[model samples]
Target: MGAGLARFARNRMALFGAAILLGLLLLVLATPALFPGDPFRLVGPALQPPGGRFLLGTDTLGRDVAAQIAYGARTSLLIGVGATLGAILFGVIVGGLAGYYRGAVEIVLMRVTEFFQTIPAFVLAILIVAILSPSVTSEIIAIAAVSWPGIARLVRGEFAALGGREFILACTGLGASDARIIFRHMLPNCTAPIIAVGSLLIGTAILIEAGLAFLGLGDPNVMSWGLIISAGRAVLRSAWWICTFPGIAILLTVLAINLVGDGLNEALNPRLRER
Candidate 1:
């Protein structure tokens, strides 16, 4: 763990990405106190350009674009983290069981996972959100339902590989329960890959949520980057700032997360670290 941290710290791009993400997180946390304005409420004249009063300008609805981005950061991060956690939990359980047990358990779980994998993830997510209702919670569920199959496959591979290792066999010989061997002895060994994958998964979750919101399937009550872009699309020629600023925010955030994930992957993988 310490070595992995050291390697990650040494990566300049990773540090840069971490800095960007941290700044975004601070902005999100400070928005309520610093801005202290309603993101949805009309604050000024509609279609205002970036300058003087509004840092990012007013949207078509006369709401502060900057505030919307700030608030949207909160929404995006919330959904991203929430959906990622749910996916990871479901994936770990399904993958762990299948990999540790193999045989019928593996066959059944893998087939189910493959069934999900066969569907187009974004399309499936859209269908799920449409059925469940357009809300943050629904978006989380949809993203998780679609995203877990990848994580399940990753975990299943790790477990299958680790299950045959000497230490795992030794643990089994020591009379450890299957659960103990799986969770304690096996899971820990592959946690680096899981963490790396989970980081990437968060970024994917955020992107999916944004896409859903762009399609007008996001929570109507919450201000999100995608919603901002969707609202500004019609007025793009005249009020470019409305969409441009939020679009930039999404791009930078997703890029930063991907950089961090890549860094983690390199730091955690022994072969990559050696290279």
Candidate 2:
């Protein structure tokens, strides 16, 4: 673990990404204590621009924008992490099976995967959310349902590639069970791609959650960046801070996640490994 950390630290871009992500996560975790009173507390006047009392300003509802943003970090992180975990779990299981076992099983699973892949994730998430009602739980489920196909396909490819290696055949010759071979041997080799994809998926999940909230399909009780943006849209001309701050938060987060993912991809499987 220390060596791994050292390697990660050596990559400046990845380290920067990690720092940003960690800081954001810590902020999310500490929001409750950092902000006094409720995020929805109408202590200030509505549409108050940035000033002495309200640093980031207040929304039309007289809520503190900075407080709301702090609370929003929690919501966005929760949704993003939750949805990504769901996708990774289901995608790994399904993809592992389809890749390890050929014949009818692979055909059926791949066909289902392909079908899901054909539909646009945003549209599918929207349809699912619409059916399930507009809430955070429904939104997470919707995003998870649509997000797994790409990961499944990537996992399948990785598994298939690993399967052809001589070491796998050697394990087979030793009379190892299929389960052991797949789980112990092949799965370990798939870690590089899994880690890389997971980083990217986190960003995608955050974006999806934001979009859902923007469309009014978010948790009503929670303070999310998307919800703030949505609320600000109506008073954009007068209360630009409503949307501006949250939008900036979202953009920075997504960019940081992508940078980390890209850096990890390059670091984990260097050009030397390809040779």
Candidate 1 C-alpha error for residue 33, in Å: 1.1
Cα lDDT of model 2 by residue, 221-248, tens digit: 8889999999999999988999999999
Q: What is the C-alpha lDDT of each candidate?
A: 0.93, 0.87
Among residues 3 or more apart in sequence or in different chains, the pairs in candidate 2 whose N, CA or C atoms overlap within 3 Å are none
- For TM-score, the strongest prediction is 1
> Alpha-carbon error at 115 in model 1, in Å?
1.0
**Candidate RMSDs in order:** 0.9, 1.7
Off by over 4 Å in 2: 1-7, 270-275
Total backbone collisions for each predicted model: 0, 0
